[model samples]
Target: MPYEGPRVYRRDELTYNRYLKVEELLQLQQPQSDPAHHDEMLFIIIHQAYELWFKQIIHEMESCIRAMMAHKALPAYRRLTRIIKIMQLLVNQIHILETMAPIDFLQFREKLNPASGFQSIQFREVEFLAGLGNEKLMGVFLNWPEYRDTLQRRLDGPTLRSAYYDLMRAYKYRIPEKISREPDEKEREQILDALRELYQHPNHKLPVYFLSEALIEFDEYLVLWRQHHVLVVERVIGGRKGTGGSSGVKYLESTTSKRCFPLLWEARTYLTKEPQWEAEENEVSDL
Candidate 1:
């Protein structure tokens, strides 16, 4: 071991450049122009960064799904916290794209025809895994056989919403079997009634109640990101058609109201307890 006069390091112990492949990553942002538009680099970077974050969000969501399926609340809650944080980034990152004015976008926008953020498979996977599967949306990918096949698999699988009800069932909540596969309005009202009870008497199932609230937070942030996306698109492109052959901002506007976990939000309308707050107010008045 002491034979070497100079110190030596193995390939695994090499520098940051080798470990992270910084050079390779840097090479990925090739501008689609003979002489690139000044803002083209920003455009590519922002979307690329979003795709990278979407990949992480999908990874966390899948892990959460497994935990929920296994009737594990803590693991699922922890993963959902990570997902919420990534969604904050996803919502706020649109501001970076807004910095490039419409005129700047026009310079290289034509070069990006047939390519759109709508085609992001990772984003689609995140939505499908988190319980936003729609056959109409899936149809858009039919021209691309590989993407269509992958999306179809997501549609057939158990969603996080289903797995959530399964988790609640493990905790002895009376969730209907029919609601587990597809959420009907009747089933949703029944679940909302149950959720109101759970939220009102949280001591009965603290972990389950806490997890429900976390899922609601995730849902809220998901809607927020969609809202921000619509605003960003409207600000930059107005009513123009998308590069991907869709009615750009109009399509985005319709998606802002979509809910991943509707019952979680709807149930709050029925939680009318004011005892805790009233007690705090009384104490303040006495003081």
Candidate 2:
């Protein structure tokens, strides 16, 4: 039997450009600057790239939340690992923008007036998904009805923090029935105690321990990104007001301290190695 050579596909068949919509994507980077300053193209492309990565991060986080809620620590950990790497990439990407000299940026900066990074709906979505939802922040999107509605849903939805606590509760940890942004001293003590136990005796619950460490690392990287962003903005624009009317670097600096999982961070101060007798006593008290 004669072997038929691989059939040649028609031009209309799915080519790489068609599959990825490369043409449409390239067309989206329209510079608002008259005469189209060369650096402006770089500026627009960098942000578009960021938005693409943000979309992927949100996808991974949502899947991780579901995995956590289902008590599937391994899958959740994998997703978190991916998210941390993506965050690292994002942090490094800032350096590329830093390469554009402030003078070069100014050539087209004024054209961006009234348009700011603060208007990014997906950025807010990422924050809301991470348990950092601030209803007040929604004011930025009030005029964009579709974006506001989308963010409102995320504000009402389960967050990574809530899912993680639910997972911990399923594992019989002493998580409060209602975890609040500002927990009372009693609830705080209970949370710290549970975390202390987990950290001190990690061998007892290896999967949960691994997931907890990853969660904290995720939190740490987020802080690193914010800190790096503040530095970049300061380097680029000094103390100038943001195009979106923000205080620029000062505003970004404040966000560097925001933590998605405060309890995990606070638990660190309470972590300590206990004497052998105390360990046995604590174990017996649990029974």
Candidate 3:
């Protein structure tokens, strides 16, 4: 069962070939000041690494939106699927911040020159692409022309929120009657009636399953990502104010409650008349 192999490269020469350029990545950390404090390296590297990851998340989201526009949803769904994995990676990244004690951070925190995640234009653009738009957040990048332009472009264009709604509306109708068969007023009325009853009673079926499950899957991930980010902020930074000038953990925690997909969560209440959401001890118990 044993197989012999080369365990290591024997003084391998650095070929200028087409593999990932190691030197560029290795040299990315350039501290902004001289006599750089020891903790400065740690803080800078951590933030820089995050920006790289943020860029990738943005790239994937743009692809997803584009795919949906082409009416090829599978590609868009595939892109959205990778977001959960990225969120898991991000969760693990919080541990790195945990290693930086307050004393260590204080050594170099004052030298940070007001740079903050609030100024991360790419991050805000990704948020725009995801459909949780806020005009106030857009103002953070107003000083940077390229970034502000990019954010404005995405803001004034089709977003994931509208796409999600379009998908849901398509599902709310039955094919043949609504699509292929051309439903008359009476048929449309019947479709609405059936949906109303199903919403009122659980021992019933929707006109279509594909759309409902898709919407729920999307909504669930949105909720999960928001909650995870809130927890990360709470753990790493605590109650102290954020460098971004917010009220810190409490502020971030309140944001998590602002559901990106509000209607989807509210719609669950209409799923069954006999208490779809029974309030229990500090939790919701759904039946």
The candidate that wins on lDDT is: 2
Candidate 3 residue pairs in clash (backbone atoms < 3 Å):
176-181
lDDT of 2 at 155: 81
C-alpha lDDT of all candidate models, in order: 0.83, 0.87, 0.60
Candidate scoring better on lDDT of 1 and 2: 2
Q: If scored against the real structure, what TM-score would every candidate get?
A: 0.89, 0.92, 0.70
lDDT of 2: 0.87
Tens-digit lDDT track of model 3 for 23-122: 7777887776567777677777777777787888788777766765555555666776676567567656656766667666766666774777778787
- 2 against 3, candidate with superior lDDT: 2
Ranking by TM-score: 2, 1, 3
- Give residue 190's error in model 3 in angstroms: 15
lDDT of 3 at 112: 70
Per-prediction backbone clash count: 0, 0, 1
How much lDDT does candidate 1 score?
0.83
- Locate the minimum summed-lDDT window of 10 residues in model 2: 278-287
- Give the total clashing residue pairs for model 1: 0
Candidate 3 minimal-lDDT segment of 10 residues: 173-182
